[model samples]
Target: MHRDLHAVTFDCWGTLIYEPKREQGALARREIFRKCLQQHGVEVTEERASDALREVWLRHWREWQAGISSDATDMAGWGLEAFGIHERAAVERLGCELAEASLEQEVRALDGARETLEQLARREIRRALICDTGYSPGRVVRQLLQREGLLEFLEVLIFSNEAGVPKPNPRIFQAALDPLGVGPEQALHVGDLRRSDIAGAHGMGMRSVRIRWQNDDTSDLPDAHAVVDSHAQLRELLHLDGS
Candidate 1:
């Protein structure tokens, strides 16, 4: 066992997986909402639904900037409520449906994602995921991991939606330490976003690695223990000489 580190925490979207065809995924969600509204006898144009979704996203963006996080399902409900729909169960179901639509190839595991996870498993190191989810809720994100065979190695799942606070906030990252039975010094965090992942883990006293993936612009980068381009580098950095 690597005595210097007890656990590895990762960010979900950009770090471990890439959700391609983002436009198509957005369209799938919009269509779901469009149909849902039609069923509720409030038929509207696609642009109208898009407007409502955009507004809701803005609200969440503000909350996130303030170090507050809310679930995608909750945001979905709020967006629907703005259009005069009040069925709580129905709203939640629709919200989930929107997220479910993105679980295909459009949302796929990033390169080296599997290799890194397997190496971690082989080494018997604890693993966890911390993400700020707004477009996809925790349930759907978990399903994506399950589908790709990555969920088994992860011992903990922390989402801003469920955590009630997003990244750059020490509270959210602090929540993972207790479950993993590891202190800040014993944990390493890997993520793509400098503002959230690196800063949040650093704030909580964990060594942080920022993965600079393709098309991921990283200028004026935040301070982290290291900056890597791929999961392979991360494994190497942690001294996991690939078998």
Candidate 2:
């Protein structure tokens, strides 16, 4: 049924990259932000900085659900707002700094990630990346993809922070289509989430593939054109070897 497929778009988190749970990752990020503020001569308590970040994320979560998107530049400014520094220039600079530092943290690509992408490229299938960022900025995510050598394999990239609205919103999905010059019917979308990836693509008339890793549970979700666990299974299903 996907005879007309000309493009493939992927969800980043839980799909291309595996993020380990670091009990102290947020704490570490907060410390980095705190230090950056100190270097700028603005002092903020660690506890206050952490709380501000949590609050901003919670607010952004609600906003993202309502179809609003934001970026780390804003978070960097908002986080420093806890210390009463309202200069836009200073806040934006600090946000960039925070994101750059956070990129040095650990983020591992999923098994078969590089191999699968390389094969996709070898076969000349156009690919894109769409993701909603968490504590780390989209800037950090892009750098991670580059670090993992996955950046070159993608043709389009859209992150929630940069998109200003999260998935399930058709705008960002449309953005993915722009570079490829493909309509929804000419593309397939692969992602782990029902609401964001699958549903968003479905809503736009794009074929959707639901992907699940070993630890993912998506049994209760609506149907997809294909359900796959690993890149090998996906390659088999798509017959990417040119069979």
Candidate 3:
């Protein structure tokens, strides 16, 4: 155990919990968009809706790579414009429905995640989450985390959509670290992505551990200080197993 460790921050999607039915969630969101467009008296096939959704996702990816973030509302507006339907009410409704669609899918916490957090809490090490939001914004993510019983352990939750910036950017990391009253060197960050999570935490002068149970990112970016395949290994690495 690192005697100087004061806090630990996590990346939500692949680190703590994962959407087990991601493809199903995507299909559901596409169907929801189709129905929303139909309600606006605009006829669109599922193929067209899928294309629009794909485009919006691509746009989001490009923006994310450039250190910009967009939320479900922005996605909704872009999607509506793609279908040539820009009714204000329709955009709002579609945004809301899209945001809530993930709730219909199964989201499960990684193995040993709760136990790790509980141990950390017991040891008085603060916890926080710095997640990059996609279709689901910060508010939706909070509901998912709460449902998984992980929210109570996290004192600070910083979503890219709410922060107006994504990981690999120093500001987002600071957003979590500042409120927790911990500096970069005193905290550790665990996440899946090398480009975003690992790089971001290191950039802030914090130790980073890359968890690969959910996603094994193969990017050429610098590797984290340590890599673990599961939260079980993470517990061992952090010396939370009471060795």
The residue-by-residue lDDT of candidate 3 on 96-173, one tens digit each, is 999999888899899899999999999999999999999888999999999999999999999999899999899999
Which of the two, 1 or 2, has more TM-score?
Answer: 1
Candidate maximizing lDDT: 3
RMSD of each: 2.4, 2.9, 1.1
What lDDT score belongs to each candidate, Candidate 1 first? 0.82, 0.79, 0.92
Off by over 4 Å in 3: none
User: Using TM-score as the measure, which candidate wins?
Assistant: 3
Backbone collisions counted per model: 0, 2, 0
Question: What are the per-residue Cα lDDT tens digits for candidate 2 across 1-243?
Answer: 447768889999788886585545677778878787787797878777788778877876786777777666777766777677788888777767666755666778888777777777777778999898765677688888988889999989998877877899999899989988999998899888887788899999999887897445455757678889897777777777453
Quote model 1's TM-score.
0.89
lDDT tens per residue, model 1, 1-243? 144888899999888877677778777777888898888898889999888878888998888888877765777788889988889887888877876777743677888888888888788788899988877778888989888778888889998878888897887788877799999989999888888888888888888888887546465757677878887787788878657
lDDT of model 3, residue 59: 94
RMSD of 2: 2.9
Worst 10 residues of 3 by lDDT: 82-91
